[model samples]
Target: MTVTSARFGYDDLRGLITRVVDVKHAPEDSTLDVLWTLYDRVLDLSPERLDSPDRDRFYLSKGHNPGSFYAVLAAKGYLPDAWLDEAFTAGSRLGGHPDRTLVPGAEISSGSLGHGLPLAVGTALGLRAQGLLKPRIYVLLGDAELDEGTNHEAMAYAGATGLDNITVVVVDNGSASHGWPGGIASRFTAQGWSASEVDGRDHDAIEAGLRGHHGTGPHAVVAFATSSI
Candidate 1:
């Protein structure tokens, strides 16, 4: 169930992260800031409106280490703060990878790389087909995940189709085995996407980069961090 009380602040996030024990994998430390910025400022989603057709959708494609994602969800009151204590345990719904069926606010079950963006593309198309154009589709991806061929296909398709309702945030920790030549933003721009690059740690820059898209086509924001998670 969703909580209706006042949401926890940034200060409470560290404590929430510490609640999870025996976590085999943890999201990039940089992801904490990005997740917080989205939930706290950018996203038009809340625990109370999970079922709303007009609510925006956020997919976490970089779900190998979901500790930060869980913390953000807890802070936003989508999941009880206490549930975090049992994360990854046998009895807990929270796991190493987020499950949409188990988590209150998760829009998709994800862990395998390269699937989230494709799924978001399909979702945007589906929503448009249903005349539900108010909801935007947002997906978070890791820099390394871009190496997947499937993601390239999805990116090309979304761009060619003028999928303006879609926004992709790529946390670039510089972990991609084969890095882009002109940088990540160029990859998207070449595919007809509106793109921007920003410091991953700067909340204002991140927000600006995300909002910079003006409904031309799909937008991609590459958040560069100093180190890999």
Candidate 2:
């Protein structure tokens, strides 16, 4: 059964994170703030209109660590709070990687790196083809995942095609083995994308970064999780 409660809020996210203890990485420290901000302020999505064609789509590319993702979904009443307790257990819908078919609010079944961004691009194109222009697409990925050539190719294609309906959030915890020379934002800017860097932990800064871009092409937000895991 679905559980929606007015009592769920930002403060309750931590408790929900603790319930899912099987995650291999502590990505919650870096991603929780941004996840909360997106669900709370940026994305035009909710539990009620999850299947609506006009609803915004958020693809979690960095799916290896989904504690914060699930927490924000529950906090925003997208899924039952009891499901968090059963995460990664036998028969539980919540798995190590999010499955779109199983999870109520997940837009894509993501776990493999370098796939979500491309999939999001394809989805945006599909939406445009269907004349569903009101919806926006958001994809969140780890900095380390940028090492994949497919991501760069996808960024170039999105930028070249002027896919303005898509936005990419890169959570940078300094995890990239071979870092970008001019910074992560430069990688996108070079490919004609509007890019910006912000303090990942600052909600206001993150909100601004997410909404600051007004380019005709896609936008990228490099959220530096300097003080986080």
Candidate 3:
């Protein structure tokens, strides 16, 4: 039974992330652990959702934080936490970047900043080609990732193609990773996309934004998160 992080408010989520981040030097490691915790505690979480033609797809574009991703998977019952100890020790399945073959729930081998969303768009298009339209593709991007031209190209393409099934999530913690002027949402909107700006730590806000969302084109969700872990 997965516990909906929903029950926990933004403050609570922040606390959890803070704790995880403080516990490790590598924020990616902390994030992986948190993802694991969510998996373990959250109900009905599974990568199997991706297998069904009608199910949703998610791509973590901020693949540098493999530790967080891995942890989340382990918590969700996809990967074993013990793997963390072993992989970090040797040339193990777990590496600095995500290896989809080793991690079950990870949708793509994400490390290249701008590739995840494009890959997600492709997946959405592929599913659309197969006549599965309702299920959408969600991509999580880091603030720093915006600097990559590939991401902008992907966003522009998504807008031009009118990919209503594609959603772009940007996690911004006020970091200088990307030259996000004013705000990322505004840039997305300028690119002809419907954007939603929210507190990344707020589960309720996140749920609302997600549920209330109707992607006419590629929707960009800007999450102003302070700490990703």
Number of the top-ranking candidate, with TM-score as the measure: 2
Higher-TM-score candidate among 1 and 3? 1
lDDT of 3 at 205: 61
Error of 3 at 123 (Å): 1.2
The lDDT of each candidate is 0.86, 0.88, 0.63
| Tens digits of per-residue lDDT for model 3, 1-229 | 2222222332333333333334554344323322332333322336446355676666777887565565555444455555655554465777767777766667788887789977887888898899987777767777887888888888888788888887777777555553666878887888778888766656556554554456567787776666433
TM-score of 2: 0.94
Which tens-of-lDDT digit does each residue in 1-229 have in candidate 1?
6565447898887677768743333343668788888998898988989999989999999887787888889888898888888887888999988999998899999988999999999999999999998888889999999998999999999999899999999998887888887888988999999998888989999999878888889999999875333
Question: What tens-digit string does per-residue lDDT give for candidate 2 at 50-156?
Answer: 87899999999989878889888888888887888999988999999999989888999989899999999999999999999888898999999999889988999
Task: List all candidate RMSDs to the true structure.
Answer: 2.0, 1.8, 5.3
Candidate 1: list runs displaced more than 4 Å: 2-6, 21-27, 227-229
Clashes of 2: 0
- Work out the TM-score per prediction: 0.94, 0.94, 0.79
